[model samples]
Target: MTEEELRQRVAVAKKFMSALPFCHALDMRIDEAGISEAVMSMPYDPQIVGDPETGVVHGGAVSALMDTCCGFAVNLHPECVSPTATIDLRMDYMRSAKPGERIFAKAHVYKATSTVAFVRAIAYEDDPENPVATATGAFVFSKSRKAGKGKAADKSGAAA
Candidate 1:
């Protein structure tokens, strides 16, 4: 895509996602942009507690951020559509992300086909050298056999 087009598309995606009910509440924001990569960040939220004693962010929330980050990375290709689902999502939690800490993640699209895409990313708490978790996922592109934007997939093996 042209530089201007890229800017416009990024702007559009940012506005679309930023306005999302869940995304807005979590402080999620698109952080970086490129042809095959994207970065996103979210601050700690009281609503995302998985364990009260540890003040850890819920694993589900982490997966949500990772999924969207990867999806945006794939969509950066300029030929992509919004209707996609995570075929598989594997998250490796090296360390629990603390509730007050910020999570910054960068996602890369390793490869893509008409039906499938491979992606990976690292998420850390303000420190790239010490990532809190890593993710690898397979996502499928879906289009209108009928009209719909498609649904986000479950982080587990369950279907979307």
Candidate 2:
């Protein structure tokens, strides 16, 4: 895709997450996006501590980054603004994220069809190859339609 098209995709992803409560609270930021790839970043926060004993980043936080990137990647599809649902999110932990560190997530669309969208991504600190975790997800496009150019996804495509 052209740079202009990628910019528009990134803008759409940002707009889509602007209203997400957790996105705001976590301070998640969209680094960039192309036709099938998206990059997102989130810093370690005290609020997202995984364990009281170790005070390391929680696995859920890593999952959240993956989910955000995957969802954003799906927006690249030319299906209009259809509501999408995360039917499944599977994550594999390869390491741990130290506190005060930042996690960078990169997601790519493996395949997308009318009923199901598939995505895979990896999360790591500073380096992209040294994965802290990896995730795969399947999303069901909003079955119903919704109003507005950017809005919450509907359960069905029938417009809410």
Off by over 4 Å in 1: 142-160
TM-score of each candidate?
0.81, 0.81
Estimate, for each residue in 135-160, the C-alpha lDDT of model 2 and write its tens digit. 99998753223333344343334575
Write down the lDDT that model 2 would get: 0.80
Question: What is the lDDT, from 0 to 100, of the residue 122 in candidate 1?
Answer: 92
What residue pairs are clashing in model 1? Answer: none
lDDT of 1 at 37: 85
Query: Cα RMSD to native, each candidate?
Result: 8.3, 6.3
Once superposed on the true structure, which residue ranges of model 2 sit more than 4 Å away at CA?
Answer: 78-81, 142-160
